[model samples]
Target: MRVFGMQHIGFTVPHLEEAVRFFEAAFGAVTCLETGRIEADDAFMQRRLGVPAGCRIENIKVLRIGNGTNLELFQYSGEEDGEEPLKRNSQSGGFHLAFEVDDCHSAADRLRQAGVDVLEGPTFVDAGAMQGLTWLYLRAPWGQFLELVSMNGALGYERAGGPKQWSPVTGE
Candidate 1:
């Protein structure tokens, strides 16, 4: 089998409502579908979802962000919930999501106005494969690391005839 494109990314959050609201208010994400609370007294939860037998999934929401990406947000309530602390990018299994904006500076300002914690630079890369790109990092309310990125025209690699980078704005 061969891969085509990404369909969605799943995130297990502490509070479903808060995550939904944050995505909607901060990034204009729209809720497209919801699978209400799911639970089982038997081993179905374990066999199917790989959760503990008595574990319960409080809710699942599917949201669409910007032009394309879809996010599947899940909220769980069980004995094992939140047993593991969130990880940083430097740690194993740690990851961050990046959103492409028209202007990185304006996006950072909007995030600051929303009282979001802006972490690192909206810094520009001077002479590299990523030349002309500006990016910054921020933290979501639930502590997920996110990035804001912007690029004008094409990148250095593209200008040098390397493979084109995938962009939501250009659909490439």
Candidate 2:
């Protein structure tokens, strides 16, 4: 079976409100849905993925930015005080999420001005057909990696290196 593109990314947070605010301010994500009573099985899906169950599952909020993907945030009711999750740059299971921007440098600057901790710059990268394109990495509020890439073409089908050539073949 062939795999399609990503649908959404989930993150477990101690405070859903704070997480939502952070994302809204940092990435201009808009709240799409907020529910306090998600099914137990649905909540357990996150636990099945290795999230500790000590925290009490309370609410879930979904936010969407642009038309690419959605961010799912969950908040537990009685989570014990513990160490914060490691930063995206650090060794972690899910590293980070990338957002294509019109101007990486301006995006980084805007994020910094808005009080978000931007790790690196709108540095240039040789992305094949997208040669001389600029890209930058930023740390999200919950230690997740958010990348901003600026290029001249579309998101995934950018003709950076050169034009893609297709050849037709006959099925036997």
Candidate 3:
């Protein structure tokens, strides 16, 4: 057996309201569900969630962005909470969620106008396998890395009859 498709991607944030608001404004994310505070004074937090005992989960929310995976936003409070800064791309386990757009340049401009921290270009790939692709990186209000990408027509591989990559734009 094998996995079918991504159900959701979850990440803990320092502030749930700020995160939800940022996602909604930035990506037009829709809030699908929310939960009240969840806390336990025993090993449940440790055994089930691998967190320190007596930790409290302040809130949880699920958001739908475009047609991609549902985003699970979590806010927790405990001794270990906020102990580390957000990781950069150069660090291990560093990752960013990419949103496919029809026009990378326009999207990046809009993001910049909205006061989002956009980094550098919607860089164009002029050669190699990624030719015809454009991408830009930006940071969410809570420091999560995000990307905007666009593929102009077909890429080098797709032009050669390679398997088309799945996209929210094409739903392939």
lDDT of 3 at 24: 91
Model 2: colliding residue pairs: 128-160, 128-161, 129-160, 129-161, 130-160
Total colliding residue pairs, candidate 1: 0
Output the lDDT of residue 144, model 2: 62
lDDT, residue 1, candidate 3:
85
Give candidate 1's error at residue 87 in angstroms: 0.8
| Candidate structures ordered by lDDT, highest first | 3, 1, 2
- The better-scoring model by TM-score among 1 and 2 is 1
Instruction: Compose the digit string of candidate 2's lDDT tens values, residues 86-141.
Output: 54456556577777666788888888998887986778865554465577887766
Q: 1-172 in candidate 1: lDDT tens per residue?
A: 9987888999899999999999898899999999998756647887788877666888999999987679999998875756687899999999998999999999898889899889867999877888989999998898999998998878888888998867899776
Candidate 1, residue 115: Cα displacement in angstroms equals 0.4
Per-residue lDDT of candidate 3, residues 1-172 (tens digit): 8997888999988899999999999889999999979857657788888887767888999999998789999898765755687889999988899988889899988999999999999899988888899999999988899999998688988887788888888766
Cα deviation at 29, candidate 1, in Å, is: 0.6
Clashing pairs in 3: none
lDDT of 3: 0.89
